[model samples]
Target chain A: MSDVSSRDRKQSWFYTDIVKEHFFHPKNFMDRDVATDEYDATGKVGSPACGDELRVWLKVDPGSERIREFRWKTFGCGSAIASTSVASVMVTENGGMTLEEARALKPMDIMNRLGGLPARKFHCSVLCDKALRDAINDFYRRAGRFDRIVVEASRVVDLVAKVTDHDIEEAVLEGAHTLEAVQQKTKVGIGNPGVLPAVEDLIRFYREKYFG
Target chain B: MATRHVYLDHAAAAPLDSRVLRSMRPFLEGAGGNPSSFHGDGKEAKDALDDARTRIASLIHARPDEILFTSGGTESDNLAVLGYARANKANGCHLVTSAFEHPAVLESVGHLEKKEGFTATYVSPGRDGIVSADDAIAAVRPDTVLVSVMLANNEIGTIQPVADIGKRLKKLREAGHTKAVLHTDACQGAGAMELDVEKLRVELLTINGGKIYGPKGIGALYAKRGVKLQPLQFGGTQERGIRPGTENVAGAVGLATALEISSEIREAENARLIALRDTLIGGLLARVPKSRLNGHATLRLPNNANLSFLDMEGEALLLYLDAAGIEASTGSACTSAALEPSHVILSLGLPYEVAHGSLRFSLGRATTEADVDYVLDTLPPLVQKLRAISPVRVDEKYYV
Candidate 1:
């Protein structure tokens, strides 16, 4: 108790040293607004309404198929900021990773590099990788590599609302744990009894996948 | 460590006053008898407890016996809501409270509704963050046993129209339209606003020691004379059987001293802090782009400045401010264990983005012009830095 009080008085760090380092001084971060033409392709995920949003700008070398420059901007908590910062480093370190290698980089790798994030903050790590994948897809789309572009698997859950299983999963990741909560967030399966089972299954899957 | 440390999270907790500590030292040291005992030592302890109770009661213009001490604000709120509603269940089972009440009150009402077979109505505040008294009173049915609206909001710092609701409830009772009793959680308003219970016309009022520069873990609930409350605990016969357990003599003395000091200095201190609060609020709005205040312009507490910066999360801004030696708080979900933004900010009909980006800086006795100036100088750059990295645009169309 005494040790805790003394540390508090001294202003102890709220996160791990690595997280603090990255959050205080992020790497490969775009600190100023840049012209859209500067980067080859940009990927965006999440929304400010969801309490977190990430955007990554990637310049991939066409010949080597390596990511030449990786820049990101995030509006999120400490964990999100630190996770994106380290993910940027992981993708761009040592002459950068090839397109396939970058695509293979996972949230777990970023979490491991940052030592570990708080349990509740695990979802924050998922965002940067998703944004990075979006950027990768953007690269493919811009290059006219239509066949190479990967689309996330999702099924429509609410026909009227156009809500999908992926939307339910994202809602769960944003702290809507119950079916009703997910519906409140994404309006999934509302007034449509047929898709309740699928919505519930997706909610349970994402809750266990990220939380358990 | 940063060279300048400006503590602005006073609404969360304040540093204990030296005078209060001095008043509490005797009870903490040599005077160790329980107020429940009948021996001489116990008599001395009981005297201290009674004196504290009287002082606390006088602060709110209530009878000495009406002040019931508890562990803190949460417990006091729990006892008032749960105890009162349970005891008065025979009269009615319906409850009414504002949507933005502290979880202590909200959870108790929720428990009554879910676990018990009671119904409740939650009245939301206006865009100005003020709970309308007419709306609250309109929700009070004949079966409504209790109507609770906080004296001031903890997050946005908007001073609620609790007194207006109290007066309306009194009129309803007189007209035999409803049996609902009014309660106000004055935890955030004790030191900054008038506490005369008669003027407020509230049957129950909760005040916490921690927010008033006293020792933590001590609070008092002012129950009107003849108000019936079923005890939440049954360990002892203390607090007239409303709140059981041996009295916290040291805490009681500390709270009394702190309340007395606050009452004496409230006027001058409020004048001083209001200047700092306005400067902080006005300077931030002028310096930062796309920033807006959260609570009512002039109806908020004298020491509160809650603002939302467009296009960035509050937790990130709070961290940067902390790194710059400016301690503060936020309404952002990331700062909360439940991963939900402040209900108070959301109650004002704000969008999730605005709620997530809200920041609160509550001034206190220790705040000064220099501290305010330091924060004014340090915060604009941090907001700019965060905004540069944020994907959301600052344009008005974005919010639309």
Candidate 2:
């Protein structure tokens, strides 16, 4: 028998303010009228047998990008519930970063806030944060205006560059038919230079690059 | 509006009362002398130890001297089963116990069979999770030295008729066979239920601190004065040489304090818990279809509500509920982590999927009607969500 445990049992691991708050008065968790910018993610933590689950919700803005609102739904330990309680403030107050960034958060910050979690259940804090991020990602995906897109715009400078690239073309080129036929029979649409042939080549390039 | 935090799952462990805490403080801070030492300090410690023994004995209706303080239920069970099996090996090695016994008993029995030359019979409980005294009596061979049964199951909270089993053993002893001893791990029963050893007729009993809201890491084994159990450890003459080394006076005081308070509250707690427990359980059954309650409902503990939701993993539901801010357990906690079906549920012959999804809610002092209501309101949707994702599914063919 280990006569004395390191912790004072009189003040059980459950007596801490955070544990009581989590176990007694959890906050920020009614989502019926929650907004669209909620950084959506899915949190499916705990085992198939242990029966603990946590889902967190965070709403960050694209402009000033501060967490506008935060909430969660937790179904397990007091520490896990407290983790959500503490995490909501952490993510929302810290200028709500990207959902991915929130997903990557660590639990030590929560440990510091809640005093600390029981050594056996440190994962509850991690689950809380992960659930929030998962919900955030899920929320955005549902919104359609979620992923960022980048496309190129055209300019006249590119058109001039294309003309210069054909100046040193091959010696013999075709018109109307094959380049060999043009060379053997007659000069067709070889503009005073080779504008028509260059246009045809440009059309083929465009077709291969995009239209195809 | 405000709500109460439902404190179900008390069978997991309970909260110590102010009275218990008040009784424990002095021992933890002041009563620091070694009971083995023979000074004024030692005398004070010895007196305190005696007081705890007497209190524990009074709760169980056993003799004070029979109480051999150990650490907790696991140690007491090991000392009782392994110690007795090893000591009486010459008499015969056949031991019989139920399949739904706590791991403390089942695992220890396994060690004796594997390490020592002993044969064990694992009796099965019926579909209602009740073991017949006749069945256990029948398993008792002429050579059998011991029979260990739990007063109440820790997970499902099925209260085994250990008193009845003890009576049968007593009858057998009165006729001829006097070698066999009956032991029960009553750590779960000590607090919320009556624990009169004389009424139960148990020769050896297991009582632990943590389960009864005392400090953890302390417990006692009740070894009837003449019941021979081999010593598992050796060091000093402490605890009558049965358990050696320096004693845990603080823990004992705390345990005694907790036990005393628990005894006082037993009746009131039982009534309150049963009423709230029925609501928590009955609500789930009514709201969630295709869910089954495991174990004998009325014969079970006042606070125990073990349920098996069809076509789902208890862990998945647990995680879902966790996110929802409702605390609960899935059968045995460690068994849940293993992702394997619980041995208790499996012993009941449930399908592996149902076994995997078994949940137990043990209500305690902190539990409230609001908490029960919260669970009732929150759980079924979670079950539905999980059923949607279950790999091993149940539809019209399986939902009964």
Candidate 3:
């Protein structure tokens, strides 16, 4: 409490003016009614329960295999929304990016383009790149290339105890009714309170299905 | 694009009223010397302080000497809870409070329980976020020495049954149980409700100037005569030595002036605010599907409407609303920056995501029908836009 000044704490919660501008006026967010088939591939990352989730869809031209258009949907904070907004613009700025160029796009590139996010919200930038990579993986999967399926270890519930969503589900199946009960069963949220939001979501999800 | 910046976060703090400023100008500029001094300038200052005290005392139906000035509502709250508990410790160390109390009261009660040898009972609110009198009464023990409840919740705007709770405690004392002091943080309610402390049956009541369009630095605690209290601070004997600091003369004048004006105009302003509040609440619920009103529909503060927009993060929605010049609060004003979902909302048995998706729009003197219409016009499209990008499926009956 002594380390952080009240003014600094208040300022840290705000996005840079540029980030706010992009967030308020996002570039190419997907329409809810847009058909799944409209995009060549789709990539998804994070979970709503984790308090951040993003999905990116890309329409690639068959001739050049260059990404012709990008659209996305996200359930996250201001930084995550702004990061996704800027990333979409970065990838589609000069007519389009070749699939390789899109693949090379990094979280730093997105963060730098948006001025910057708060240090605690750096993970929001990371989610933008992960979602894009997942989209590329989807692009490969749709082209009958089973070998290109990059099974990134994205399914993590507790980083400290190395607990996964599957483990949380198993514990819930054994009648873990609350977050505390699930922690007793699988030690999911005990190590990281940061992950408890996600853990709580999974507990509810599983309990609704199994207990109901 | 509308350039008008509509302020609807009045519960966070209201802009100081111009009338209050006019009342405070002489005290700020020419009214010199400390109220404690005995010189000519000091006599002038003392007169101002005495006049302010009388006006403030009259506003709440208390005698002038019962009012003790502190920095603000937080200090007033700290004084009432900590002071009362410590002074009466020989009698008992038991305290009672609601689970949804503001942090000032909560943290003070927390410190007493953790560091001081005190026991506490936290009564949870009913589903509508109102503390039931029965629940509060049931939590009272024979040894309970202090019961602190806010007159109105700052976040959800739910008015507690503080009067009823006070009556019950009055009964308990009449029955020869421990003489527990009933305290209410009337910071948020002083502007919106009737605040006759004697009528409310509260022994100690808190009022801050900021929420009532007075100055920000001044708050007053009304301790009923003969209520034993230990000072939280020590220095020269100001505020009867309970809060020993040089009196903020201009602040006292501003606070008293604000209170006097509030009582004069409360009825008309309350009617106007209640109408605007209903329009905003009704419009949002009607225009935005899946939007749910938080807190008790009828028992809430007239100017407050807390609503949860399904499938959108509150901070994200707040930014969108902020961009459109519609200022609002997500959760309590103090903790909104910390970004944890509101514990007050969660205490109402709301799912966390629903809590996370909530916004509080508190109308004030500046709010107009046009402002309400502008918000109704602006907010629905933004909610639609956010829901489009949201990963949480509204159809997932579990999330709702």
Listed for each candidate, the true contacts retained, as a fraction, are: 0.49, 0.02, 0.33
| Per-residue lDDT of model 1, residues A17-119, tens digit only | 9998999888888877889878988988666766777889999999998998899988888888899999988898899999899888877799889988776
* Candidate 2 C-alpha lDDT tens digits along B126-145: 77888888899999988887
Please list all clashing residue pairs in model 3, or write none if there are none: none
* Quality of candidate 3 docking, DockQ: 0.21
How are the candidates ranked when ordered by DockQ, highest leading? 1, 3, 2
Which ten contiguous residues of candidate 2 chain B have the minimum total lDDT?
B331-340
Best by DockQ: 1
Worst 10 residues of 1 chain B by lDDT: B391-400
Candidate 2 structure lDDT: 0.67
How does each model score on lDDT?
0.84, 0.67, 0.81
Better of 1 and 3 by TM-score: 1
Q: Across residues B44-106, which tens digit of lDDT does each residue of candidate 1 receive?
A: 999999999988888889999989999999998998999999999977999999998988899
TM-score for each model? 0.90, 0.66, 0.84
By TM-score, the best candidate is: 1
Among the numbered candidates, top lDDT falls to: 1
